[model samples]
Target: MDHSIGEIALRAGVTVKAVRYYSDLGLLDSWRAPPGHRRYDEDAVGRLELIRRLRALGIDLPTVRAVLTGERTLSDVATARAEALAVQIRTLQLRQAVLRVVAQRPEEIHQMSDFTEFDDDRQALVTDFLDAVIGDDPELRGIRQTLTPELPDDAADHQVCAWLELAQMLPDAAFRATVRQMVADWRSDWRADDLRPGVVAALRQRVGPALAAAIDPASPEARAMVDEITADYARQLGKPADHELRTRLSSLLETAGDPRWFRYLRLLAAVNGWQDPEPLQPIYDWTRTALRHAG
Candidate 1:
């Protein structure tokens, strides 16, 4: 059964004027009552709801009318809207980057177009940081990939914050240099240890359990863990575990193993929406304790 235009508007959460406008546009099915009152088909409420949904997605009146009249499929229109949203997101991200640079470094306002050019290669900044830190060795490909955060067009608030913080940090000259050399030491003379993950893997394997068990960093157990790791390193390098090696290893751990830079890794994980790997700061802390504690 048909209902008056007022009933259709109430059901569709629209005004009576809107229902009449659609009816005037021939987009709604309506009939005249015996008393000449305009009534709409029950299905008009469903159709009007669909029309509103499409309009909210930014579909124009002509396209929405086509959709209602069966000239276009809803699936096709939805896919088009999704693709449009992706493009819109990319444009907004580019603008946000430029504005950030301008705000952070007003002196660089003359070169603001550089940020605009970032649209062509969105990863340029990230790539430079990774190259400076890890170098361009093929052996480091996987680690490099893991470290770079890809902020999607539709990122969550935390992810956006992570990217903003990372972008700010990427331009620091001293931090970049420090991390560059630290990665070299962490990988342990990359020429010999082409397996870049092994040194950290070895350290983590020993320290993870100790950290979980809440063993004192200065305890005998922590000391044993340190001794075992140093021995393993010596075996890998075919060098004696002597004063020179101990001193170098201790310094390396102090430099690279600081949890300071690990903060950036956590931010990277957050930005990329990845599970944060086990934090290595505690591992370094345990090793540092063992080295200082002569017991």
Candidate 2:
């Protein structure tokens, strides 16, 4: 038995207009009955239902037709659609990350817009920006590597945000100049043991406990911490850990250390999945304060 257009629409749980639209597109076949009225077979109901499912998945009319006509298999269409949706999902996620950055730093919104996607050119620009600011110093090569955000094609939400923040920081004139000066000052100093890994490791091992204990920088405990750290540095530099050396080290710490500069490294750690080295900052601060009044 044949069903009228109204019956087909009712059976498919669709509107009369939708049934008519699909019929016009040749997706639903209809025949003229005795009274010249449109009549649809049971197969037409199944066709209409399939069309509805494909449209719900955002498949275009042509692709839907291809599936209907056997030009493409259902699996082929579904696979292609899934890949397209993945691309759209990534685009939306990146947009969300960009907006989050924009909201947090409205004044820097201009810098956030250029990163809708991180392509090779953008990656190269980021590297060049770092190289220009960091200079060609062999001593800082490790630092350059640590600070760069190597964004993968499938970066996570936090990684994307890190990349955006890193990008914005790269072009900042004041941040660049401060970092450059700090590197230069570190290289010029004879007792800048912080730049040496073994000395820093020693400082952290000795000073870390005192900092955590909240020992007063002026107290004997904190003074002992400073003395131990300075002795190690003095041995490396072949100088005595005297009051003058301690004063000069305190002055250098005052000039070069900035918590804001450390934020870049924190962002890098987030992007690269590194163990967070945040505890070192407080230890350094505690040592700096102790050294200031060591004399």
Candidate 3:
């Protein structure tokens, strides 16, 4: 079955000139009829549709002709297109990060080149910051890895923004000392040695609920909850549920709740593209209030 040039163009939803152009390029088939007018086979409609799609992807006539003539596999054409899109998407993300810095953090625009380059010196700065805070203990290797953020060469928009935010904090002496003290305080309690993660869980599992219920920290309800939490901490430490241990629990959770420390975890998660950790600031605040009013 054959179709006139007009019929083929109409069926393919293209201009007649578009169909003729492809035919002229030898990418589509057409023949002269007895009347010396061009006619296309029904297959030309399908081929014209393919040409439109391929051309829209920026494939030139020669490659499209090769695809149409079976000189190249459609898979090969698709792979090239997918790879090109990956590069384009990565570039767009970087452009978006720059735009955000200009629009939102105009004052910080001078720092744009740092993220753009992300050279070895920039990474060394991160390493030094981590070492000052987390230390070089062999046992802390896992903890160091978890806290450290490795910004990739082709980071996404949010990741680039995250690195920018984290970088801002890197040079702040007060913040660095705060984080360093947090690690020191944590390590002092041997929570890192025996029950670091467990202590955090104790706070979330117990203090989280009473705070949500708005229980007054000084009330018996709050005291009992605190007692149970301390006892849980004692069990993790293999210590007895005694007065000293109860006091230790208050101290334990108190140090863990610094607002700045919580922000670092969030920024770390963002930089590494991990699931944002649960918001524990409120829980830490609850613990702080509970301790303040426990008398």
Per-candidate Cα lDDT values, in order, are 0.74, 0.76, 0.75
Question: Which consecutive 10 residues in model 2 have the weakest lDDT in total?
Answer: 251-260
- Alpha-carbon runs more than 4 Å astray in model 3: 1-96, 103-105, 192-195, 240-244
lDDT tens readout by residue for model 2, 244-280: 7777666556544566577877877877777665545
Query: Which consecutive 10 residues in model 3 have the weakest lDDT in total?
Result: 189-198
By TM-score: ranked, best first? 3, 2, 1
Q: Could you tell me every candidate's TM-score relative to the true structure?
A: 0.56, 0.59, 0.62
Better of 1 and 2 by TM-score: 2
Candidate 1 residue 30 C-alpha distance from true site, Å: 37
Model 1 lowest lDDT segment of ten: 187-196
The residue-by-residue lDDT of candidate 1 on 1-295, one tens digit each, is 7889889888888889988888899888888988899987778889989877787789988989878878989898889889988887787775665566567667755544533444345488887888788888887888788778787765555665566677778878877877877666656653434124788787788788887899887887777777787778778878886666666766766766556577788888897888886667777767767767733
- Scored against the true structure, residue 195 in model 2 reaches a CA lDDT of 48
Candidate scoring better on lDDT of 1 and 2? 2
Model 2 misplaced stretches (Cα beyond 4 Å): 1-111, 118-121, 138-140, 189-191
